[model samples]
Target chain A: MQRYFIDTAMTAAPGTTVTLTGEIAHHIVRVMRMAPKDKVELVFPHQQAYVAELTQTTPTVAARLIAQLSFNSELPVAVTIACGLSKKDKADWIVQKGTELGAQAFVFFASTYAIAKWDPKKQVKKLERLQKIARDAARQSHRLVVPEVRYQKNVTALCQLPKDQGVVAYEEAAKAGETAQLVQVTQQLKPGQRVIGVFGPEGGFAPQEVTQLNAAGFTTVGLGPRILRAETAPMYYLSALSTILELQTPVVQSAYSE
Target chain B: MQRYFIDTAMTAAPGTTVTLTGEIAHHIVRVMRMAPKDKVELVFPHQQAYVAELTQTTPTVAARLIAQLSFNSELPVAVTIACGLSKKDKADWIVQKGTELGAQAFVFFASTYAIAKWDPKKQVKKLERLQKIARDAARQSHRLVVPEVRYQKNVTALCQLPKDQGVVAYEEAAKAGETAQLVQVTQQLKPGQRVIGVFGPEGGFAPQEVTQLNAAGFTTVGLGPRILRAETAPMYYLSALSTILELQTPVVQSAYSE
Candidate 1:
């Protein structure tokens, strides 16, 4: 069944009728052409998911809630992928793929060696485009939450964000043979903890940028021995996190099983 | 420093001269615009990487071997990513990214639900293009080996490929909440073992296909709960392998450290 993220809060009680309007209604009525009694998932605020059967498709689109869903696809620990702004569609690619891979949020910041500069005039438009991509990817991946996309002016501003732990992906660290930090840090994380992983652009981070992040309490770590591209690093980080946190754990009643 | 995979076997001892011609020479001379005495890393056929300095740049390009490097960037276990042929540039994307993530080989096979079809006349040319992509990605990522790209006619042909272990990435297995197989299989893998991971296309596999693979001694594994696109699943698999095999192990002298 197709899933939609409903923006508003709805009663959690079963058998309640929920009406969807605007883009959601248009998608259900025109795009999907879902008929009465057809089932679709509606995820409300606070990550509550439900199975709902369509009651009407013409004039208005509405569905009657069936039962609350028990399984969640969100990562056990929330991850914020903070990267230096990159050129062209690289950011777009990152957001789309990152959402599917289970990142809780994304942050793009300016750095000394970053090739792409975000224009002040068009920054909102650019962010809106990325936000839309995240939404679409989240829906396609059956995720209950759409990751928020944000921008910071520079590395200092990025460092100000609150996180339980922060790790900067420095090539020099990898080059120096610092292979244990990533595994060490990820292994210690408990459920509900937030982590921010900082990555560089095509040209990589300037030495001082790494120093500043280090001063601000970010540990320097390497993804692996092979040098991953700027965009590829984040995917590697997320995948590693999933492997460590999710796949390595004992089996549970998962989202898909429901 | 840049790296190139030299196709032929060369003298591994230092203080020897290696000649470069054709595309590799063109890239070093014309694209990089290197002068005499500039250093570059040349990887020989047996995965021996050596630091060499340019001797001439005119009618011929030659380099004198400086020293033999001890670091190895290839994954501890050789991994072959076998995916159902996807449409457009998805295969190209997979080969490039997968190579960087440390896949030793890639195989694209025709499957029941695959939308893309490869013409027999153009198959060889298509493999050449993917092979080139793997080479470029391997060089960019400083890998010692360029992953071989191959094509299989069907699932049976894919299963017949030699491997110490075979895993089929099934969404149904994920949906059924079978999450322990991937970790169990990967945890038992010893260094130098060969493993093949098979993935489906956008439409996924037919029931019979899964049964066929299961009967062939391929274990069904779930990557994670979230749904990954046809192109994205291979990356996830490779990244997970790197995480479990490389990051989770005790620290040692790594390739980048050299």
Candidate 2:
């Protein structure tokens, strides 16, 4: 079923009307052409969901409640992807794929190796646009939480985020049989624990750059024996991380203590 | 150092003249502006490498061997990816990625779900082009083995490959976790044992399609939680499978050996 995200409290009462506006309204009314009485699934940012029937399709696309049905699609571990803002379509592809792989947040920081530069005047507006892309990607992928897209203005400022479990994805990660960083990560991480996975630009993270991350409590981890491109690494690790924590492990108590 | 693959027997010899041609030649001679006597690494398939010097250039590219370098980059297990071809660019991407990920061979099979079709008479020629792309990818990725690229003609014929392992990568595998069908695959596979991985269309593998594969020798394996795109699934599993077997096990001496 086509799914949408709403901020409202979900109610099970049948026939209760709910209205959707903004881009989502346009998506349902103009793009999808969902007619009256067609079924759609929607959720709030919370773990609540409602299956609804389209009752009105006017200035605002509206739907009536069918039942409250909630199932979890979020990753067991909260994965945050931090990358040097890449150019054009590569950045967009990374955000979309990262969201699909269940990244809880995305950090696009300007780095020394970063080739793409954002105009100072439009930085916030650009981020707002990227935020919408992440939201739509999360909705399209049936994710419980929309991945947050943050533009970290600069690397020094980027350094200030709370140091949770951190790993810098650099080539220096040993593949000569040291428990392969990926295997070590999967075995150690539990559900609900968030990991900050750092990705570099096309030029890769400089040796000094990785040293700075190392100083900030991030351990360098390799994906595998081969070299994956910048855009490819984040998706690769995120999928690998999500696979072990979300898909492989049986349902247990939440890893996120919050 | 510049790298190129040469089909010379003397790459195994201590000192022999070898030529780098085509793109590698243009890249070294023109783009890199490499000087004469500059050291470069050249690999000969199924043999050792030569640390060669750029002795000659111009319209033709040639190098003289200096020493035998024992550096080898081969994955422990050889994998083959069989996907229903998507767009022209997608076929190229898969081959390139499959090379980097250490695939031994590739097959673009016709399937029930494939919307893209090549002229039947052109199968040999189209696959020849794909084979070239795979060869180029192998050279670029520094793969010792340039994976074979061929047209499988049809799914049934492709699935008939008598291998120790056959896997149909289905989204259903994610939810089906730990089922009798999926649990033993990783545990049973070994290095040098050829495994076949099948992927479906963008529309996804149908239930009956799953049934067809199951009826074949193909074993269905899950690639983790989120739904991977048709292109991503083959890679995701190939990487995952590589990690499970090659990266971790010291010398796989399977515990399953009776």
Candidate 3:
């Protein structure tokens, strides 16, 4: 079922009127064609979601709470996908897919090898659009939490992640170990811990980049025998990480974007 | 480090004449634009591979072995990928990528919901073409095995996997357990095991299909929280499996690809 996030204040006990705002209002009323009495799920951050039906339309649409208390699909491990900046479509794909895969946050870093440049003035706007994608994907995938999407200056600006473990995906790291990637990552991971992973752009990381990450205590790792396209590699790790952390393959109605 | 598979026999000696035939000959001569004395590597099935330099050309190029050693890049586990035939070039992408990820075999089965159809007479030719793709991708990814590209009768035939461990990649499966996918697959897997994993078309498998797999000893699994296009799921699994099996990341090098 398609669920929308709303403010906790908007929700009332069992049956009451509440208004959606901004993008949510525009999306529910305009894009999705949702209207009066149509049933949908509304979630408030950190609270159990409720089933609501559209009751009215105005500056924002009004919905009445139909049901409360239920299960929401949330991953056991909170995943943070930190990706270097890339082409527009590719970046869009990463954000959308990463959200659907249970990413709690995404860090977009502009790297030395990145061909696409972002002007400082427009960086915030650019990030907003990407965040919109994450919000939409969260609803579609029935996620309990919508991913926090943002931008970073470079690797040094990497967020002080709340994750128990973090990994830097560098292909060259393979030569140094037969089981180094798994060992480092597995060691850091305790069951039910959130994990953050980083990936480079198409040109891959400079040798110094790996050294820097190693110095920062981010364990470098490789994917496998094949050379995956830059976009594919991080997504691959997200799937595996979620599997390990959650301890099950989640099968729901397929809901995601490119 | 581009390695060519030589179907022809090699003399067990230092100085000898080895003829390159078929597509390999065409690629070396026309594509690589090689003249005499160009260094290359060739491997005979179940034999030591060697470094050889081109010695002659025209119809068939001859090369002399410069060095010989037992070499292999085969993964410990043998993986078979069965995908529902799809329309939007996704199936082709799966074949190419799965080959690179060390899938030992591939089956393009016609599911009840499959939109792509093939004529009976051309099945062999189609599989042959797909086989060539696997061969090319194998060389590019430095895989020791070329996935056996084949087709199945339909979903009925597919339900009976001619392999040991079976997995059906259904988004629906992931929801049933908090983390059943990785737990189930990991529990079943041991070193050097051969397993078959199935994926559905964009439309996905029916409830009956999931039940059939359960009855037939196949576990229903979800790729992740994301709704991957039909092509991306299997590749995601293959990449993760490689990491898990190897217990480490792979070395990335530009020299290996064709």
Candidate 4:
């Protein structure tokens, strides 16, 4: 079934007719050509998903709620991927893949050794584009929520953001054979906690930058022994996190359970 | 410091001058512009890494072996990422990212639902390009070995390839709440074992294809609840494997140890 995220909430009970307007309505009525009785998923605000059957498609695209979906695909813990500004297409790649991998948000900041700088004039446009990518990826992945994309002026600005825990993916940590920090951090994560992971650019973090992060309460950690490129580190982190938090624990019985 | 993978083995003892030629030499001389006494790491055929000091940069780029490196970045278990062929740039993206994530090798095969088909005439050139990407990524990630990229005609060809164990990422498994198989398989993996992970294309595998793999001793596993792109699945598998096989165990003291 096709899924669409709607801006408004569906407060009425099941069997109530809900009309979709704007882009989503055009997509359903014109692009998908969904007709009466065709089932589609409508995700409303607050991450509620419902299965709705199309009732009227001629004058407007509308559907009546069948039932709510119970299977939640979101990560148990919310992760904000904070990365140093990098060169072209990397940020876009990160947002798209990160959303698919269950990140709750993404933050790009200029660090001491960052090679790319977001132009003040073009920052909004770039962020909007990234946000769109995240939404598309989220929809494709059947995620109820789209991860937000944000920009921080510098490392200090990134540090000011609130998170339950913060860890910086420092190359020096990996080079120094620091292997336990990342696993240790993940082990400490509890459900619903928000954690931020900081990563560097192609030219990794400077010594002083790492120091500042350390002073600001971010633990320096290594993803592994191998040198992951700037963009690869976050994916590794998210994957490892999901493995540890989701797969390793006792199975959560949900609608998908046999 | 720079790293290069050399074609020939260096059997000479320390202090003996070894000459480098071809692309490696040109990269060290023209690209890096190194002078005498500069240090570089040269990896040999059997994954031997040695630090060498430049003897001369003139006639040929020559260096004297300074010492041998004992730190191995390769995963404890060899992982071959077998992916159903995807559309343009996805294969390239998978090869590069998979190399950094410590996949031992890559195999692209035509599955029942694969949208992209490799032209027989263009296959070799495409493989070469992917192999180059693996090499560059290996160098960038300070890997001891470059992962070999291969093409298989179909699922049977992929299954016929030797591996101690195999797991296929199945969307149905995830939807059916099959989460234990992957972690169970990872837990069962022993050091030095070879494991292969299979992923579907954008269109995903047909039901019969999954059955065929299951008959071939490939256990179906879920990466997570969220639907990951075909290329992203391999990265998740590799990263999760590394986390389970490398980070969860006791840290091995290496050269960087204090």
DockQ for all models: 0.43, 0.27, 0.24, 0.43
Residue-level error in angstroms, candidate 2, position B173: 3.8
Per-residue lDDT for A131-239 in model 4, tens only? 9999899989999888999999988888889988899999877888788788777777778889999999888888888888889989998888999999999999999
Better of 1 and 2 by lDDT: 1
Q: TM-score for chain A of every candidate model? A: 0.95, 0.87, 0.83, 0.93
Each model's TM-score, in the order given? Answer: 0.95, 0.88, 0.79, 0.95
Predicted candidate 3 versus true structure: per-residue lDDT over B88-167, tens digit per residue: 35766778778877789998988777878878988888888788888887877666566788899776787776766887
**DockQ, Cα level, model 4:** 0.43
Error of 4 at A156 (Å): 1.2
Give the runs in model 4 whose Cα sits over 4 Å from its true position. Answer: A249-258, B249-258
Q: What does candidate 4's lDDT look like per residue over B7-66, in tens digits?
A: 876575677788899988899889999999899998888888889999999987889988
Q: In model 3, how large is the Cα lDDT of residue A207? A: 78
CAPRI tier of model 3: acceptable
Interface CA RMSD of each prediction in angstroms: 9.2, 9.6, 11.7, 9.5
Sliding window of 10 residues with minimal summed lDDT for model 1 chain A: A249-258
Share of reference contacts kept by candidate 4: 0.59
Please give the distance, in angstroms, between residue B190's alpha carbon in candidate 4 and its true position after superposition: 1.3
Docking class of 2: acceptable
* Native interface contacts kept by each candidate, as a fraction: 0.53, 0.19, 0.37, 0.59
Q: Which 10-residue window in model 4 chain B sums to the lowest lDDT?
A: B249-258
lDDT of 2 by residue, B1-258 (tens): 556776645425666777787777888888888878788877787746668898888667778888876544556666778898687777877887777777888888777778788788888888888888877766655566778888877777886876777888887666554333332465466656788888986666668777887898788876665556677777676666656554442222222211
